[model samples]
Target: MAEYSLRAASEARELIVKLHNSCLTHINEVTSSLKEEFEHTLHLESDLGQWLDVLKGRVESPQLNSAHRDFGLSLYAAASGLYRQAFSSSRSSLEVFIATTYLSASEFKRRQWVSGKLDISWSYITSAENGIYSQAFIGEFCPAAQSDRDEFVSLAKATYRRCSEYIHGNVATSQLLPTSIAYDKEIMREWISLSRTTLLVTLHCFMIRYFTELDFGQQRKVEATLEDNLAHLVSVRRILDLPVERSDS
Candidate 1:
């Protein structure tokens, strides 16, 4: 077993707390700006206007249904040394964000899926064989993600594996339960870094897709706001040494 250091653990908890606050602040700022824009430019009758409504609904769903709220609670859990729960919650949030991104790309598909007329499953959405990995989906829906497809898939798969161990009560996770409540510094660091990067990238992709459907004037306004907030998110990715290129607009 790896030795645990109290001092190191405390520092890691502090770092996680700081990162959590920074991420939440940026997310709120972006969401608020988008909401303000939507209210100012209402157009419920048009196709693009209806699409924005759907985007607004999905972005707000995370908070309304507690998915985003759980992320914040997970950070508190990590700060209290509940690393297992924290990791699990992070993965859950990523899953929701991914689904939301997929849905945001198409109003007809999302409506069908939500109304229970579509026969798709979560596995199908994330599947390597016929899901987001297929070129058709990437090209037609989320071309921006194609820029760093390899990195995105690698990170998602690796983190999903690690989180599954904790969620399923696997032997690897059980072994850690008997140890000190405090998590290893490196493990906590990795979880926070991975979770933040996944969230920011997902949000950026969603925003980019939404922007593409807007007229030039509205697009410029939204893009300006996004680029301003994106600079800070990119800095966080750089500090974690994850993938700064993934943040490119």
Candidate 2:
């Protein structure tokens, strides 16, 4: 009996050691090979900081704070090769972010949410009829995103569902995600691409809700990112009033 227990303990220690080594190896691979993709997402974090820093007082909602922190956590998880955790966190951030804007119009609703009285409605937030991305809802706050309503809404819904796949461990994802910690270029590529998409979607939603409220100086804080990431769209150029560099006319 004693010998068996000792052998079991040794095997357990070996498994633990193997797991840590796998994690370390995967981290090295991600940081080295995916440097460009990872840094691109980091840039979004910088843009987010500037946007929040300028209006920290007004945007002090707990949900937004949680969402921002989750975005960072998602990046960390991705680097650590925890793919499921990374996707889950990113999806959560998406939910809270859009929910923040959904709750913005009503202080009472916001307060109720803060006090645990109101629940965020994902269906309503993404409702094709009147949700945040709907023509009517967006036209009220952000005309720039209005023209591209279907595009943003579709991207948002698709990404949300994709992340849920990892979370729910659906049949396809079950086969995709390895049973143990390991580096997978394909999955890593998928995640990096998803991260950028999530960042862009969130940025659009954020700008839709609050960008115009910023003074020109404050807007300039995030202008570079918007231009770099969003300038291809004529609607964005129109909203920012950039020069007619393109022959959209």
Candidate 3:
């Protein structure tokens, strides 16, 4: 018998456990370096989770649930140095949230989606003409914010393409990844930035889709995140109804 042939299965199991233990230790070692990202990670989780908590019956869907679940998984994957998987999961969650917003406008299309008859086209979702970020969509939902559509359309497109680079394993992305799991602060920081971008884009869609319809209490629940991330946007400022200057009357 070959010296290690019979024990291949056992060796594999041991290797898996060893890798898992190494990831845990790496997580500890990198905590200080990732302070900002870790803080933002916690904040993003809370923003999405709390927003859902307040949505309870208003916007219920298996897709939304799954999207939120995947967002959480992305954070865990990042902590474990599964950077590629982390970005992929984040992109999927972002896609689902945008898709949910798009489908909320039409039950027929939504049913088609649920039945797998219609597809979730990222191009359609971000299209400058008919997408969630389009002036037409915003005009219908919250016309006060129509002027800002192009900005978010750009953001949505850029963030999605950034994640897709990782998902498709372009030459540069492949070269950037490690052969084995190990903490990569540069990539981890980038993931954190992408996570924020994902949240910002998703929240922008939700603001147009659901904000006006939310009861004052519901609006109050998500306002902090909305303000913190998007207060600079003319559209978001309008949605939040921040005070306007009147030159002291």
Candidate 4:
């Protein structure tokens, strides 16, 4: 009985040692992952800074007007880069990492299954859209007031949700969210088309109301309604331009 008890004690010690070793291994892996992330973020920020420096030069070039189209594309890229980092930075939690990885892999598999296309590059679409919106004109029209900036940011968040839904092959014809006023010009092609048509009519009605010289309270109401309704009108216009059919294949 004493020998059997000694044998059990030996086995217990071995298990404890094994557990300690496993814990060490886990700690090392987590440390390595954090280091890698730190280095990656540092490199990303450095690259973004370089892009900003180049943009500053591009902004001052005498031929800027002639190159405005290309300039616009570059600006979008820069903004997208900054946004990518910003978005991913907030997702430092383990759940976010797991969720993003699983979602990305699932989406990739779905794309392959649907189209038989296996070499899809997700970054290309992401970076291209970002580059397009990063232009000089966008900077010129950026809201200066804190309240306006906050509203624009909210709109931007909503627009991003719409874009994500469309990109993910999930949005139904009737479900797309409204486009926000805060979007860069490069992102507004569909809205631009609507603005040239139905949207212009709405704007004309609002302009007449504003310029007609109503009483103070009436003018305030008109102004408030114009501010609130403008985004809705633009979104509706954008909705008109989106394809009605879902492209699963």
Candidate 5:
């Protein structure tokens, strides 16, 4: 397996931390702004206001328990070592984001069913289940994603499989057996870049769909800020020869 110097590992970890912080900041800002806007403009007793309340609950619930945030923190903690743990966390983050995006795109009936309200015996929605839910979400709601559906699914599956190898004690786990506890800078950079990009893209789509009433100017400003923060990760994606899409999809 490839190895990296301690300095290289430290630098990569720092960059990952920066990206993680920026992403969380953006999420908080957007959610706060949206909540304030809704509270000020919509009457609580009105039908639309009630609907907004439900939407807000749903959006905020997942944001609070975000696997993306959890995984990002795990990556930062394992920056100097624990390669297997980092990969497992990354896989978990991806699966959670996929499920969130799918729920946002699905119809109300489906969402209720997934929540187990419609059928007490039914299992709650969890994993993306081999990209089926994600594929459906992209097809129904994300126009830009539809064009690159095959590539998106392929990349997501490949990333999940690679992470799963480490998690499931497969042959690839041998890569983590080095005596020196350090991660390859190039590998860590790629993993963080991909994870951050996937998360931002999914969050962008969810926000756009949920905050449909957000004014154009405010929406543009929020998106511009997110893009600015993501600039370095985007560059890393290019350097690593990964797929790149400027849009949320």
Candidate 6:
């Protein structure tokens, strides 16, 4: 049996922090780009920071306006999906892992953690589970013996359960609300910022785990993987620049 090393874990931690910061930066850039068109008075970047301040349970507001609520939820849904795919494990069915671990949840079936209703026509939790496995990438990079791969998959699933519970379940109870128009703007910005940051951290861990599977030297691999993941994150930001679209028919 192999023991986890502090040095590798530390490197991973640094990378996760960097990823989180990079995500904030990307979100700010995009928000600033759109502020002029939206005729928004508040600087979205600053609004996001303020939102985080409130999320610490410092203050509370009355009901958030529908537009802001919907926008924040939509961003959360998309960001959650992107992060899960890059970093977390596949969470197709709650019971899919319940047999292996002592965990069960009904919310996984109903509140599937995406922005809107989690379906095109079929009932599927595509967002949270999308790109989670990366079977092809894992096979190519983290190649392992059949038994070892199975074990890795199981562990990853377990990790997903833990992380999801923390992020999706716990984070929802945050005491913040959209009070003013500025508050609403801040809410959207903050959600976007946090989502990107979380995703970056996740990718950082995933890449380090990837290198470990290949028995590669940790220090060099960590640096290389962080850089690659950052670039990928930038590309993802561009792809999501379009306005949020949903239907109520």
Best by TM-score: 3
Q: In candidate 6, what are the lDDT values of residues 1-249, reduced to their tens digit?
A: 134687788889999887666556545644565555232322332232332233232111111122234334434332332333212222322222221111111335324422245432211211223222334433444333222333334444454454355346345523333221122344344434433333333343233233343323333434443443343343222322323344398
RMSD of 6: 23.0
Per-residue CA lDDT of candidate 3, range 1-249, in tens? 676876997899999999899779767756778876788778877787767776668444677888888888988888888888898999899999899878888888988898899987999877878888777888888787787787777777888899899989899988898888887878888888888888877777777888888898998989997888778876677667886544465
Q: What overall lDDT goes with each candidate model? A: 0.54, 0.82, 0.82, 0.32, 0.48, 0.35
Location of the lowest summed lDDT over 10 successive residues in candidate 5 = 40-49
Relative to the true structure, candidate 3 reaches a TM of 0.91
Q: What residue pairs clash in candidate 5, if any at all?
A: none
Error of 2 at 12 (Å): 7.6
How do all models score by TM-score? 0.55, 0.88, 0.91, 0.19, 0.51, 0.24
lDDT of 1 by residue, 63-159 (tens): 3244455555565555555667777787776666566556655678767766779755557656666556446666665455455455555666676
Residue 204's lDDT in candidate 3: 74
Collision pairs in model 4 = 75-134, 76-130, 76-131, 76-132, 76-133, 76-134, 77-130, 77-131
Worst window of 10 by summed lDDT in candidate 1 = 40-49
Per-residue error for 90 in candidate 6, Å, reads 14
Task: Give the Å shift of residue 14 in candidate 4.
Answer: 71
lDDT of 5 by residue, 1-249 (tens): 135687788899999887677545534543354444323222211322222334444643453256546565545544545556667777776666555554555557446745767532101332244243245544544333344444445566666676678678886555544444443444554455555444544444444344344555444434433343333444323423456787875
The TM-score, computed over Cα atoms with residue i paired to residue i, of candidate 1 is 0.55
For every candidate, C-alpha RMSD to the true structure in Å: 13.9, 2.9, 2.7, 23.6, 15.4, 23.0
Better of 4 and 6 by lDDT: 6
Ranking by lDDT: 2, 3, 1, 5, 6, 4
Best by lDDT: 2
